[model samples]
Target: MGKSKVYFTNMHATIKENLPQKLRRLIKTAGIGQIDFDRKFTAIKIHFGEPGNLAYLRPNYAKTVADVVKELGGKPFLTDCNTLYVGGRKNALDHLSSAYVNGFSLLSTGCHIIIADGLKGTDEALVPVKNGEYVKEAKIGQAVMDADVFISLSHFKGHESTGFGGTLKNIGMGCGSRAGKMEMHSSGKPHVSHSKCVGCGTCIKNCAHDAITLKDHKATIDHNKCVGCGRCIGVCPMDAVQPASDESNDILNKKIAEYSAAVLYGRPNFHISLVIDVSPYCDCHSENDIPIVPDVGMFASFDPVALDVACADAVNRQSVIKGSILEKNGHKHQDYFTDVSPETNWRVAIDHAVKLNLGNKEYELITI
Candidate 1:
C-alpha cells in the first residue's frame, strides 16, 4: 500500500488565525470536503471528558468539526457510547450529565450530544467484522452505525490499556456498545462481584439467555448459558457484574482493530486527533495527571492507522515533561508510551489494522 497523506498543523497560531480556525484549515486541507455530506447524518465521535478529568478535547474543537459538516449540508451530532467501567459515563443519563458538566451542551458544540448506546448501554447494532479473527460480529452503538458518515474527533493521549488512545481507539472502543467493549476487554464472560451485588436481580431480568440467576441473594452467571453479550454488566445496579480483563494486551489490541474495521467499513469516515494534554491515563479517569510531553498538535487523515502512527512518532520526538509520569518512570523503553505503561504494546493494534487493510502504516505528514 502507498503511504497515506496525514495533514498536520503545529500549535503555533498567528494573530489573525487562532487555534480553532487553524484546525478548520487543517481538516479542509486534509480533504474532508471530499465526502459528499448532503443532508446526511454525521456522527462526530468524541470523548466528552469524564466529569473531573480536564484533558478531553474542548467543545470548541467539536464545534469546528460540526460547523464544517453543517457547511457541507450535513446534520451533525456529537456522540460516544457509554463506558464499560463504573464512572460518570456508565449510562446514557449519567453520560449526558457528565458531558454537560464538562461543557458539551448543544449550545457549546453547535450540535446535540447523543449517548450512542441508549439509556442502559444496551441499544446496539450487530455489525459483521470483515475478515475478523477475534470477533465475527461486532456490537456497536446503534446511533453510530446508523450514521451516514463517521468522523472521529479524538484526543490523542496515553491509555493504560491500549498504550495510547488515538483515532482507532476512539472509533473502535468508543463506538462499541457495552457488550462490544466487554468482548474487546475480556476473553471470558463477566462475573458478579458478590460483594457489590445487592440481590436486586436486575441482571436476571435483563438477561435474554437466562444466563444469570440469583444464588443466595447474589447474582451468579452460568457460563454455559452466557454468550458473553455483556448485558448483565450493564444492568447490574450495584456494579456487581465485572468484565474479566483476561485478554492479553496484544489480543485486546488486535480485537480493537477488528472492532474499528467493523465500525468504519463501507462508510465515509474521517479522523482527526488532537495530541494535546498528553495525559498519562485515559479520560475515563476522573483525575488527569500532568502531560507526559509537550502538546504536539492537530492531525487529520482518511487513514486511521497511519494517523495514529504519525501522532505516536510526533509524541516520541518531544522531550518528556519534567515531573510527569513518563519522566518519573525513567523512560526505560525509549518509547514514551511504553516507558509509562510498560505492560502495553500499542503496535499490536497498528499491525492488526494493517493486516486488516484498514490503513497503511506508512504516511506522508503534510504540515498545513
Candidate 2:
C-alpha cells in the first residue's frame, strides 16, 4: 500500500565512526528499537559464507546487530539452515566449523551460532503458507521457526538462479530445511551425476523411500517412489546427487517469496542488507569473482521487499567496475543484475512478495 521506509548509509566512514559503528547507528535510526525485545529469543538469519567466499558480510557487522539486540535485552543467536548443495556447510558440524573459520565465533559476533536444521538437515518445521500457489506447507528449519523474533542480516549480491540474493532470498532459501530447499529449486526429484557417483550406496542407505538403487556401481533414482525430500543430496559424500533445477526462474522466485512469508508470518521481523562486494554470484560459491559494481552501502528496513528494491535501484545507478563481470558482459539490459546474469529477473521476486502482502515494492529512501 503506502511506501515503506528504507534507511540507507554510504560506506564512507569518518574518523569518529567506522563501518560497524555506522551500522549500529543505521539500524537504531531505522527504528529497530520499536520492537520490544525483552528477553525474547531472536534469530539473526545470515549466510556464513561458504569456506573460501570472501564476499560475505564480516562478523563485525553481525556483532553490531547482536550488540544492539542485547542492548534491548534480547537473546540473539546467528542461525542458518544447511545448504542443499555440497559444500563445507552441508551439515551442522561442518557448517559451524566454516562459520568459525570465517570469523563468526561467539567472541567475534557476541552471539552463538546455530545450524537451524539440526545435525543432518532433516529436522524441520512444517509451516503453512497462506494463499500459496506453489507451496502449501513450507518445510523450514525447526530452530528458525522456534524464534520469537527474526532478523535477516543479508549480504546483497548477484545470484545465478534467483537474479540476486537479497533479504528475501536469504530468509526464504536460507531458512529452508533440506527438503524445503529442494521444493523451491525444483518441481521434480533429484538425479545422480553418473561421473561423480562412486556407487558408495550412501544415497541408497539414506533414502527412506527406497527411491535410489545402485546399478553397475552407479546410482539411479526412481522418481516414482522418490518424494523429493532432498535427503540423498546431503548424504552423498561425492556430491553426485543433484537436485533438478527444472523450475523456471520466475516460478522459483515466487516459491521463494511464499517460503519467506511462511517464515515471517505472525513473527516480529527486521531486515538489513549490505550491498558491498556486489559479487556476480552467490556467497554459496567457494570462489567469488570481482564485484560487478562499486559498493553501494548498507540498508535496513522493516519491509524486505522494499529493502531489496531500494538496494537494486542504488546498484543500478552506480557505474560498473572496470574488468568486472558486468563490464565484460556489457549492459545490454541496462540493469546491473541482468547485465551480470542475463538469464535471471530479480523483479519476479519483488512482484510476488507484493502479491503475498509480505512487503511493498514502493519505498521512501531515507539517508542516515
Candidate 3:
C-alpha cells in the first residue's frame, strides 16, 4: 500500500477560526465528507478529561466535529467507555457527570453524550473477530457497536503506560467496555488489602462480577472465580486494591495493539488528533502536570494506526520544553516520553499495531 494521508494544521490562530473552520477545511481536504453519515448514528469517541486534567481536547473542537456530523445528516454523540482503572469515569452515571463538568455537555458539542458502557459497566457485546492472535471475539461497548459510524477525537499526549496516546489509543482503549478493559489487562491482577479496606462495602457494591466481599474485618476476592475486571481497584476509598504483580511492559503494549484491532474491525472510521498540552501522563489522572512540549497542531486520517504513528513522529521531532518533567536536554537523540517514563517503550505499540494489520507503520504527513 502507498503512504496513508495524514493531514495537519498548526495551532496558530485563536479558537474561533482556528478550531471550527480549520476542522472543516482539514476534513474537506482529506475527503472526510464522502463517508455515508446521512441519517446514521455516528459515535465520536472522545476522552472528556478528568475534572482537574487540563490537557484533554477542548469541547470546542468536539463541537466542530459534531456540527460537521450533523451537517452530513448523522446523529452525533460524544462518547467514551467507562475507564478500567478509575478515578472518575468508572461507571456511566459518574462518568457522564465528569463529562459535563469537563465541558462535554450537549450545549457545548451540539450532541448528546453517552457512556458506552451502561450503568454497571457490564453492558457489552462480544464481537466475533477471529484474528489469528485473538481466539474468538473481543467485547466492545454495545452502544459503540450499535453506532453506524465511528470517529475518534483524540487528545494526543504522552502516557506512562503507552509510549504516547493518540488516535489508535483513543479507539482501542477508549472503546473498550469495562470487561473488555479487564481482558486486555487480564495478566495484571489486583487484590483488596484488608488493612486498607474500609469495610464500607463500596468495593462489593461496585463490582459487576460480585468478586469482592466485606467480611472478617476486611475484603476478599475469590480469585478462583475472579475475572480481574479491575473495577474494585478504583472503588475502594482507602486504596485497598492494587495490581498484584506488574506485567512486563512489553505485554501491556502488545495487549493495547490487539484491543485496538478489535475496536476497528468493521467500523467505518475517521480520526482527528489534537497534539496539545503534551502532558506526561494519561488524562485519567485527576490532576495534570505542565506540558512537556508546546502545542504542535491537529491531525486527521481514516487510518487510526497511521494517525497515531504520524502524531508520535511529530511529537518526537519537537524539542522538549524545559522546566517540565522531561529531564533530558538532548534534542538530537532523546525520546521525550521515554525520558520521563524509562521502563516502557512506545515503539512496541506501533510495531505491534502494524503487525496486527491495523495500519501501515510508514505514513506520509501532509500539512493542511
Candidate 4:
C-alpha cells in the first residue's frame, strides 16, 4: 500500500530507437517479465480506433506488447468487447470489420483480434466483485475472463462521461459485456428512441425476455418484463434502442472501479497507457478533434490505478494547446479533465479504485 512505481518515457525518439522500440524497452523495465507467461493465453486489451478516430493508439504499439508476450513464450491476442452503442463495433462481425478497416489486422499488429463478447454481445462470464457496493456481480466478456494473463494497452484521453479513459476505463468499461456496460451506464434498461425507431423488429426478435413490443410501428420497452440485459440496444438496426444514462458521474466512476475489480482480482495483470492525442472525448466517437495538450509519453505499471494517476498528473503538468477545448474552458477547475468536461471529475474513479484496494493513488513517477 506504499507508493507504487510508474515507469515513464517521453515521446522523444531518435534514429537508433523508434517509438515502438522505446515502448518495448519501457514495458520491459516496468517489470512485465516478472509474470510467468510461459504458454499462457495473454489478452492484450486495446481500442482499435472507432474507424475514424485517429487519436487512438496505433497498431504498432499493440505489436510491441504482443511481440513481447510471444518472446516470453506466451500466446497473445488483442481483444476488446463489443460496444453497447450502435456503431461499427456492435457485433463480432462488424467489430472485426471495423478493426480491420482501422488497420488492426494480424498482418499489421502481428496478432489476431478477438471480439470478446461474441457475435451478439451476449457471450459473457458473471464475475463476483469483492467488497462491491455499486455492483455485486460484474458481467464481463467471456474471452477476457478466459485469458490466463491480462495486459491493457490504453490510450489515455479525455472522456465526456468519466473525464479520462485510461487503464481502469479500458478494463472496466471496455471489457464489459453489452449488459455490463448497461449496468455501469444506466438503470439497467434501454428505452426506444421513438424518432430513430423504424419499428424494426430486430429488438423484438432478439429480446429473450420478450420485453419489447411494437406499437404504432414503434418499439416500446416493457420495463416490467425487461431484464436489463441490453441485447435490444445492441441489435437495433437503426440504433433506436438507447441506454438510459441515468447514473450519476460519481456512481458511474464507482461502478467502473467495481467492474475493474472483477476483471483484475486474483489475476496477473499489467498496464500501459499512452498519453498522446489527449482528445476531449472518448475514442468511441467516430471522429476525433485536436489534442488538448501536447503528447506526454508512454507509461507502464503493475498498478493500473497508479498508472492512471501518473498519466493524469503528466497531462495536467503540460500547458494546454491553443484553440483546444481545455483552453476554451479557461481552466476554472485547474484540472484538465474536469476543465474539458465540467460535469465529470476523473478523481472519483481514482479514489474509488484506491478504496477498492486496486492500487495506491500515490505513485513514484520514474522517467526512463
Error of 1 at 152 (Å): 0.5
* lDDT score for residue 44 of model 2: 99
TM-scores for all candidates? 0.98, 0.97, 0.91, 0.98
> Over the stretch 267-339, how does candidate 1's per-residue lDDT look in tens digits?
8999999999999999999999999999999999999999999999999999999999998999868789998
Report lDDT (CA) for all predictions.
0.93, 0.94, 0.79, 0.93
- Cα lDDT of model 4 overall? 0.93
Q: Number of the top candidate by lDDT?
A: 2
Clashes of each: 0, 0, 0, 0
User: Which pairs of residues collide in model 4?
Assistant: none
* Candidate 4 lDDT, 1-368, residue by residue in tens: 68999999999999999999999999999999999999999999999889877898889999999999999999999999999886788899999999998889899989899989899899999999999998999999999999999999999999999999999999999999999999999865789899999986999998888889999999999999998888887778788888888899889999999999999999799999999999999999999999999999999999999999999989999998999988888897878998888899889999999999999999999989
Extract clashing residue pairs from model 1. Answer: none
Cα lDDT tens digits for candidate 3, 115-227:
88787566787776546363246668888989999988899888887767877777877777776776665654677767777788887887767777777868888786677
Using lDDT as the measure, what is the rank order of every candidate, best first? 2, 1, 4, 3
lDDT against true structure, model 3: 0.79
CA deviation > 4 Å runs, candidate 1: none
Report model 2's TM-score to 2 decimal places.
0.97
RMSD of 4: 1.1
